[model samples]
Target: MNQGVQGPADTGVPAARGRPAAPPAPSRPDGGDAGPDTDRERAADPGTVRGEHTHSERPLPRPRPAVQRSSVRGQVLDALRTALVAGELAPGEVYSAPALGERFGVSATPVREAMQQLALEGAVEVVPNRGFRVVERDARELAELAEVRALIEVPVMLRLARTVPADRWRELRPLAEATVRAAASGCRAAYAESDRAFHRAVLAQGGNDQLVRIADDLHRRAQWPLVGGPARQRRAELVADAAEHTALLDALAARDLEVVRALVGEHFAGSV
Candidate 1:
């Protein structure tokens, strides 16, 4: 089980990954070790440096600051979204705020705040004091979202395929390649972010900001990974999906309207 969030009174906070360690303290002017007087003085003062010269002599690090609950809530909400997509959080299953807070290594306040936003997005429903229940999406609802997206996006994609400059398509190649690398690495979070970026770059070429935003929301809802399984199979599936992205870019660059349209339809269909 995931450990609970460390509060101010806790002994230590989990170190953030990839954070560089502080530099070692400079040696004493006389090159003498800290004497008992120095140790006693350091014990009484939080700011004094008193440790061995091999390590940083600064005071122990404290728990991460939680002054900005709003920012923290946004991060928690994103994590919840990924968890839901990965099948780590099941549909129709009720989850308590404390449980989610512990899972996220945050206080219950921010977790509750995040659930409220998810409720607004229709991803979950409040259950009074019991917490929130994940909302189940039926096939009809998924179909409807796809239909709306197709209506708004398919025409734009088709038009961009014919009208957009080849230079623009070339510009998007890096984003498509990033998705492939992310999938090949078998990192779901990396792939998800890169996948969304690839789609957004494609849609933005049409020059319709509102349409892009709407289509992005629909895409996210449809892209949730409901099937949980072995890592190898998941990696293969992700690689296949990434290949489709590359194929779509190739078709667009070639100005193959028929192929582009067909690929777009297949992409949307795969999501549902």
Candidate 2:
């Protein structure tokens, strides 16, 4: 239901949560939900700020910029990816350009641009005379990705554990808490981005930019499939994940890479 979604199959990073918001598009500055500031401002200004100052000074929150129509292509990519991760778009499903073009309300040009990108990302296969076909991911591939993740990630995590001060996660706790809030509220897209943030924060402590980049790619390719469901469907899972953040913090506090590896192995192994 993401705003203005003309197509059903999406490709970028998408959300399979509730319908897209009606007027105030869910996507705004800082991703979504500027939160309490907007609702509270009206009480302070009482609509007078509009006359006294430019609308920018009005007590109510300044309006978010209208995302350009060109950005629609990226939005389309994100929506499609969300649906695919959520399993709404099954493997082997072949989407035609004309069909997708009609769905996004753009011509086939954008759809073609977006689909080609997805295909390059290994999320889909391009066929002759057909549009992008969903990649048929199986248990073996999932298991392989998990193994690769462990191999590529454990050393980087260990380096961070050994070299960085454990208190770094304290600096990261706010983002983790925000992600948890997103999960609790059933905001799939927000939660996904949050999850990505938490992992990167930990890797940042490792101090190796190259390692961080590799770890990121592994996380995205392997982790997306595990958390695509509505947070409620995996309520217990999300709860455990939140606790795992604390566990990681504890390990970092002690500079214990062994514990980090064990925790990571347990987490990813369970997912596979």
Candidate 3:
């Protein structure tokens, strides 16, 4: 969540950031950008002899210039990731870059670039002419990710609960409280972000950046929302989840390892 949520300055890209971000560049005068599905052309029937075929192949549509402000790419990537987590980009369904570009009010070039990065991260897979498809995971795979997170995070939390100074754990109260407020507000975007932030802060207590990063990756995968699930119910579930964070903080502050372990286990169970 933090990865693609930053401004251009954070990334050191020659891109604009802040309020009222720069407008997208205009389409090339050379007619490089495709104007939606209006330009669709039927493929020639290869079964027919070349001489007999009346259909001529249209040149592939050229994507606009790729020198877009990196902020655009960051915004597109964040929006795409939100769609994935919100189930708008259903797992296993093909989504075209041009279509998504139109949805985000930008050229297909930057959208395609963002999708390429998602592909590299295993969030989506390239589909050749079809664009990309969100990677699907079954119940077992989701559970496996949760288990890996617990394996990586729980021990560190256990250690920190007893060894960390009381003030250090107390210092994270605002982040934990933010998750609770977000959960109560019933906004998936707010809750999802605060949830990640809360866990990330907790994992950071371990003082191992690598472990925190690995656990954060697992946390993202494990929390990918289900397609066509009930939103109201998910909100309610988030409220219940926020309770776990409160309990975890309380347990850690009290240095109760047994309660902390149980709270962590229950927090991860049936998640995502």
lDDT of 1: 0.78
What is candidate 3's CA lDDT for residue 9? Answer: 32
Error of 2 at 80 (Å): 2.1
- In candidate 1 the C-alpha lDDT for residue 58 amounts to 43
Tens-place lDDT digits, model 1, residues 29-70 = 557654446656667776544434422344466867677666
TM-score for each model: 0.69, 0.65, 0.72
Each model's lDDT? 0.78, 0.68, 0.78
Task: Estimate the overall C-alpha local distance difference test score of candidate 3.
Answer: 0.78
Per-residue error for 106 in candidate 2, Å, reads 2.8
Return whichever of 1 and 3 wins on TM-score: 3
Candidate 2 ranges with C-alpha deviation above 4 Å: 1-70, 186-189, 224-233
Give the 10-residue window scoring lowest on summed lDDT in candidate 3. 34-43
User: Could you tell me the C-alpha RMSD of candidate 2 in Å?
Assistant: 23.1
lDDT for residue 116 in candidate 2, whole number 0-100: 82
Q: After superposition on all CA atoms, what RMSD does each candidate show versus the true structure? A: 17.9, 23.1, 23.7
The TM-score measured for candidate 3 stands at 0.72
